[model samples]
Target: MKASKSIVRRTRWPDSAGAPLVTPLQPSVVYASSSPDALDAQYDGTAPGYTYAREGHPNADVLARKIDALEGAEAGLVTGSGMAAVTAVLYGLPGQGDHVLAGNQLYGRSMRMLREELPRMGIATDMADPTDAAAMAAALRPETRLILLEVVSNPTLRVSDIAGIAALARERGILLAVDNTFTTPRGLRPFDHDADIVIHSVTKLLAGHSDATLGYVAARDPEHRKRLYETAVTLGLTPSPFDCWLAERGLQSFELRYDRAEANARALADALADTPGVRRVLYPTRPDHPDHDRAVSLLGDRGGPMVCFEIDGGRAAANALVEAAPDIAFAPTLGDIGTTLSHPASSSHRGLAPETRAALGMTEGVFRVSLGIEDADLLISEFRAAIAAATAG
Candidate 1:
């Protein structure tokens, strides 16, 4: 062969008899086929082979299967980002003239998509409190096709009534899609509560380290799953093989990390509630939390790794606390291995109108903490000092 051809066409290696303990990453955007018939088989889904990474790939498939197994889903699809997964569902499941009912307290971007983006596509959406059955019922229309909600609301940490909402959706012949980003499968499985579809921002707890940005969609029904996959492919929402590989690695220790973080969260919640500057603490494990009973029934004894508290002096106090505590990173994101803080008024829900935020009880005083696998006592001490510093002036 010529120099160029030789460099491009390397000899194929023989397969090893032993299997790798970890799934190897396959980054090939294109695959070779022995014949045109074989290539056609791949394209038509008659054979088990990859034709293009945009449609499907080995690493993405492996991670999807792992997520499927974890969530008890019949089928799964991995996407480039959490918003991609949401977009896929919105576009894939419902059509023009079909309406969607969403929880009032979903992630800010999701709300924006349903309220603003979907309308441009001729799809309609209405927001209702997922915890209030009457509100949900009133919000539903004859054209309602799907219901979307988070298992736990962002920043505020409101535990949703999955079983109730699922039952209502079933009665109305509407599909129920639950974003299980916060609770994760270890804490709560939406399928067990009769959710038709489950979504995850694998960038969070599932990935655990905040290194990879990935999202997943899984369905109990095979047809919905297939539709989501097709939509993802059509939209070019495929994830990188490298990010999928990283997510799989993080998932390996997800349970251990989750347990440690949950423990720390429980401890910190109690300590913060008693602190001087804290007006309220919102954690499902705490009896004072509005959804405490629902959380215990749905998520068991653990309240999850996230905790929210309202500082006495609104944004000023929150800013002071963040500045005083150099130990806790002031990251707008969540689910890192180390403790971090997010200000909802500034980061997640900044786009919403002031009245809308007030309705959700997301006052400027509120600050969200993503508890890490740190010593509970140390976290408590740091938070107490931060609260004192913030309140002192």
Candidate 2:
């Protein structure tokens, strides 16, 4: 009548003749272990269940387990913020005198860390165009220990050839770390394309809301996973339990939210392509985009929710348009459900040098839009009105 721990049962009673029942069950706890001497052991270096909240917590573990399932990773680690995730991955692998090769259009803070801070720490780095497979290959050197790239570049919306870069890293015995914040695991899985490590700004698409700030690092190999976990623990980069709980709740409907947001993005991109005062529309699905084919192959039918466009006017005009928008909020952040716009020149990418910004093709007129679940027609009309106002001004 009662069963547990993965068993099958069949029962029949004389009183209920000719009636049969079958049931399958599993144990409540898959595995459990605890050490009696742990009280005396200050730090036994044992995985005898979480000993401290800073090192690990139940909520974080649960979220990590969920991420591991979705990302198909051996293990996952949670961090306080996305930059903390980046820092953990970089510090986990490289030490003094090591080299790192990073994509050109990386998140601005990431670029600052690699180009400015890493050098002071005796770590060398070189930037390369992620879309250029040959350039990525050529950037590797004997001292190169890591290759950092984004699944989908920020601001520009340029999708990289992750498979090609991963293969090159494998050939050189270098670790490939991909920032998959732009394209979450549901939209695209970087590990499936040969990435050794995948990182996400859980504050972004993973949370699907702007309330919680969390980051995650998912490793393809167990060893790498352990190294990341150890680094996070040592650095005290663990996220708070409450934030982890919120992020876990947000992740439940991530796939559904992404679908609606991405669909709205596609419709907005199509509408903006032919609109007046628009110099160019940049979305991964656009035919003219350099990596459109690769994006189609990697992301398939869905391109993603973020879109970047260049207006006919320069920085002033772009700023004017953002100010004139009635519906979309002008903010520095992205990957939110409500429509938000940003001027990368002065916000996200402002930390970079002017020459470096120009080199990455981040022009002054560029404006990025993170589409939400609002009506596509309304978004288009808001943009049309904003553009007209900016041009008239």
Candidate 3:
């Protein structure tokens, strides 16, 4: 039996004639070498090679290319963080006098950037309910450059009408960018439904582990790709090579992990729905959910591995439940092999103002469960025990 190929490799250098020259090469040489003139020329966009880590790296390019293929995008760019990808996309095309129509319910940090940072840059923004097609249409202005939305509202688990929003944006001659982090390309490819751009927090599902922090921006057209690449280069938001390698390694088994995690999540959601002291179960797969029909039409039968629910005892009860869970870890992050429980009011949605948080239904009792690869029965039993302990106390 043959061993699997390692993700990392060491390359031999080429001579002045661009041929692999066999000189007394050392085993420590892990990268190819080029002349100063060749390096400068290669780093420039005119050439098709990488010359620096910040501008580009072989591993990062490989990962980005794979993501591009997965998303069916013309090009893709990687960034240090999710917010960096958002910033590069938002700032790349829109100018000072431009306007943007954004979904009212967004990831807290993204909402902050749109409401706080863009305004300071002289870019005007209007928030609209993503589910209401008329409301989204009404928010568009003559100067609106883009419409940004999330496939699934973070923390709240609210699904957005991507096709409707995309239609509205198209009619108004505005670009549509969808944050597909929660509904990754494996489950839901937004580009197929009229989205012009797709952004992802690779830290989550793509990496499938909590080890690396990375983001990606995939564009469907050359112009959009050029703009995003230019902005990424200028902003210096490139991801590290090691992180990119880890992401690539994770992508190899993404399909299997995603399927298993999603199955476990559905089982957990059903169990939670029947548990006492639970106010409401928020899962995209539920037939009675607000956007259930849309989700089905867009994502088909498979829902991603995230579930949000409200506890009967509010913040104190929620905290107690988290503390009582001996197996599941209480953490602010998500998308790992082990289950993670988080409090939105102080974690993912902490950046939102009180009024905004209220509007988005991010109450203290709201808890987000990132289902992992653990056995479905074990996870349910653990949660049942935690709820029992919390309520009894």
Best by TM-score: 1
lDDT: worst 10-residue window of model 1: 1-10
Off by over 4 Å in 3: 1-40, 43-46
Name the best candidate (by lDDT): 1
**How does each model score on TM-score?**
0.97, 0.88, 0.90
What is the C-alpha local distance difference test score of candidate 3?
0.84
Q: Judging by lDDT, tell me the better candidate of 1 and 3.
A: 1
lDDT of all predictions: 0.90, 0.83, 0.84
For every candidate, C-alpha RMSD to the true structure in Å:
1.5, 8.6, 6.7
Error of 3 at 72 (Å): 0.9
Q: What tens digits encode model 2's per-residue C-alpha lDDT throughout 316-343? A: 8987897889568898877787888988
| Candidate 3 per-residue C-alpha lDDT over 203-313 given as tens digits, one digit per residue, 9 for 90 to 100 | 888898898889999888898888898899898988877788788888888888888899998998899899987778888978867889988888887789999887777
State the lDDT of candidate 1 residue by residue for 306-356, as single tens digits: 999987787788889889999899988889989999888999999999889
